[model samples]
Target: MTQLIFINLPVADLDRSIAFYEAVGATKNPMFSDETAACMVVSDVIHVMLLTHDKWRSFTDRAIPDAQVSAQMLLCLSREDKAAVDATVAQAAGAGGLPDPNSPQDYGFMYGRSYADPDGHIWEVMWMDPTAVAAGPEAFAAHDLTPA
Candidate 1:
């Protein structure tokens, strides 16, 4: 079987997170979802497991951070162009998330924006040019260095 990746995140309310992800275009995956988790498929092989904090604790001993004031990770999505990035950010905002205070960045080959989910988890929506990226690693590195 081909490899797949699942990103498991602790959520205060599984149903709410599920609703938010669905609003942002993710589809529910019943195979890994239940009362404790709402699995949302982000791609053919990339799934997000929105587990309740209690259920999440069953899988680890670590404490879940208070997402209202802290961030544990940043999930990023790639887009086809700058407009796509803006649209994604807008969609996320409309679904209850808030746009990040940071300004957008435009490298020669890429552009991006960021937003924070209702729980304060950050996600970046970006657009990159494959042809420009293929030109050289320097371009990619240069793009990454630009302030966002």
Candidate 2:
């Protein structure tokens, strides 16, 4: 069986988070949703659990990091091509997210950009050329993922 990933994140507002993710083309899993949390189905193998702050606290002893104050996590999504990555990032930005100013890296095989959601969760949108990576790391040298 193929491995799957479920990323659980704490959200300040459940409804707002649901709207934000929906704008970016994700669907909610009604089975796991409630007033305190919702399951976002990114794909068949990927899901995100968005929990209200209070509900999230119930599941963890560690304090939830204030997204505006400090970094907590970085989620990344891969695309089939560079254009696909760009489009997705654009959609995220249009839906109240902001692009990160960090430098880009183009290893010839992979290119990526970063963005932050309304709640300050960081995400990296990336595209990779499998053939280039298959050749070797040499293909990635000096490639800037950020625009010139």
| Local error of candidate 2 at residue 94 (angstroms) | 1.2
Give all TM-scores, in the order shown. 0.90, 0.86
Q: Whole-model lDDT, candidate 1?
A: 0.82
Clash pairs, candidate 2, are 106-143, 107-140
Candidate 2 lDDT over residue span 1-148, tens digit each? 9898889899987888899898788999999899999999999999999999899889889988888668866788888898887788788888888766345556556788877778888888888888877868677665654556
Question: For model 1, where is the 10-residue window of minimal lDDT?
Answer: 139-148
Model 2 poorest 10 in a row by lDDT:
100-109
lDDT per residue as tens, model 1, 1-148: 9898898888887777888888888899898789999889988888888888889989999888887787677788898888888888888888888886457777767777898776677888888888987888866665456463
Best by TM-score: 1
In order, the Cα lDDT scores of the candidates are 0.82, 0.82
Residue pairs in collision within model 1: none
